[model samples]
Target: MIADRARQAAAAAALVGCLLAAHGTAAADAAAGARLSAARCASCHSSTETIHSTVPLLEGQPKAYFIAQWRAFRERKRTAPVMVNLAGELSEKDVADLAEHYAALAPPPAALASGSDTGRALADRLRCAACHGSALRGTHAGAARLAGQKVQYTTWSLQLMRSGTRSHGTAAKPDPLLADLSNAEIESLAAHLASLR
Candidate 1:
């Protein structure tokens, strides 16, 4: 009986040690995430700055969504040639760290200055609401929220669509509305869409 009890005690102690080690590892990951964000992502994506005509703020995004994008970039499923190279350099742990860092950030302000009524009308006509939802919060699966997205990212994505470069499974054709739009219209739409909180 004494020998059996000793074995049980050892097992319990091992379990406790494992639990503590797991907690410590999680804390370390969060710290690493913060550091990585400052080093790699702060230039184009701000956590706390006001929403401007260009950069996109990446705070408070869903962790799964954020990680999925990084994975897609890494896998070349989402083809931003520049992003592909950048994301290729990250390991799974680095991706998790960056996602956690952005997920913990505060979202930026929502004040866009779109200069064209035509672009807004076109967006509405194109049924951008179908997949992106009424407020562009994005569908739960596969779709990304466009509200408060970076203007540069949005415009660049649209340009890619126009060029037959960026191909998402959910998106069918090049955004027909965007295809007909002039450069100015695209810019106005990007700025206005990014302004939505």
Candidate 2:
């Protein structure tokens, strides 16, 4: 219980920091962002049918969260070959526009939960809601929306975080909550998260 509370406190602190950092942003132009996305991001991110299993769905993400991630990729604080290169090309206004565009779109629908009850229990114990909102739909705290996310993407991301290959750029720390979980447990947690709408 104490450990869980500690984690929640940490998450809350991170949220506050992000909120402060994202303050004073200019209004974004979603229309311009749409055009830019169509021109540049369509090949991978726009196509629901052709997108890889590991590609996260960005629609309906919080604008602050989206902007933070885009900047991370652009600054090379978070590393993905294509995203680093692509995000590098975007201006600050371009990122804000894209954030607005994607944030306004509807998120993906929920999928069936294939995991057992244990997954739900694990999420409850972990208090994922502390960071992800009551519905796991995300928060203005710079946390990504998790509801109805692709299972494969969630699973892979957890594994990367656990293995220390992925981390929050600002925090620079892998989630300790994920460190001790087994592969099967991570998959179960991902399934539970994917099932929420």
Candidate 3:
């Protein structure tokens, strides 16, 4: 099972790299992105950490992943009324700038693990590092950072991914890894990920 997942991740990583290259490679202005974030994104997305459990912490997120998410919102491929409205107002440059700025910021502090041994075991069994990196801090492949992420948000995201309502690549396709997960397993994984420093 793990070997199959590793192969899948390798294939996905190559695809993502190709997609990013096709997307574009231009210099972004982080300063401009900082200004835009202060004016437009600071309300819900705090620079320090996630404002709510449901809101994701954007600080120190991978640049490629950030850009992709913003693009998804802008194109309505990922639908959230607020995000779509805000992202729709941004130009491609603005999206790149924001990705640069947020990627350079400090990540949120780690949450207390309490009893996360079980979760850690689960993560190991699932081979989360196949795509999320050994530290689960994301990768150049455009996978979102999972280390120290908000547990509620992670759980919600996993559930959405499982149901094909949200996806890393396409909304129409659900992640096979998450397809058979129960709510308990999802929560355990989220809790474990949230505890990573």
Candidate 4:
């Protein structure tokens, strides 16, 4: 319990620091971002399909949040190997442009799968809506939309967050409650959320 609290506190601090950084970043052009994405990001993040179950669907993510995540990846604060290299390849303008491109897209459909019934209740208890919006479509404040995220990606992401390997940018703390979740429980939760519009 203490460890979970500590992790949450650390995450909260990081969120503040990141939100501050986001305010001063420059704007980007979606067209320019699209061109760059085609070259560097398309293979893994292609909205047409899930290349891997763990890769996130980037469409309609909040632009500022998207920029902040790329910046974090570029700066070595985040821990995705492919994203770090891709983010490093981008110039500041490219980062902004790419964020713009992804942000302008409509949320694509994800492959939904079967799971237990507890996920929705767990999400309610977690108050996911406090940050992800009532409908989970994301906000300018940094939450990514979860409604159409791949079930595998969502389950993996929740596990990472619970295990302290990933975070919801810098705004909120990792949920200590998730530490008690079994793998099947996490999958059920992910499945339910993915079923939302």
lDDT of each: 0.69, 0.80, 0.82, 0.79
| Ten contiguous residues with the weakest lDDT in model 4 | 108-117
* Candidate 2: clashing residue pairs, number: 0
Q: Give the per-residue lDDT of model 1 (tens digit) for 1-197.
A: 99999999999999999999886535327678888888887766774344443445667665667778888888888775867998998877887787778666655665444435765775687677787778776554546667777777778777777665765445556745456777777777777777666
Best by lDDT: 3
Clashes of each: 0, 0, 0, 1
- lDDT (10s digit) by residue, model 2, range 83-138: 99988888898988988898888656644556569789888987888887898877
Tell me the spans in candidate 1 whose CA falls farther than 4 Å from its real position: 1-31, 47-56, 78-82, 110-116, 173-177
Q: Against the true structure, what is each candidate's TM-score?
A: 0.64, 0.78, 0.78, 0.77
Name the TM-score of candidate 3: 0.78
What is the clash tally of candidate 4?
1
* Model 4 segments more than 4 A misplaced: 1-27, 47-51, 113-117, 168-174
lDDT of 4 by residue, 1-197 (tens): 99999999999999999988888666678888888888877777765455566787787778777878888898898878988997888788887788789888866655555444598887888788888889987888777887777788898888888887776555344657677888988888899877776
**lDDT: the better of candidates 1 and 3:** 3
Candidate 2 is scored at a TM of 0.78
- Alpha carbon deviation, residue 157, candidate 4 (Å): 1.2
**What's the C-alpha lDDT at position 131 in model 4?**
83
Model 3, residue 127: distance off in Å is 1.4
**Candidate 1 Cα RMSD (Å):** 6.0
For model 3, residues 82-149, the per-residue Cα lDDT tens digits are: 99998888888998899889888866665554437778988998888888899988888798888877
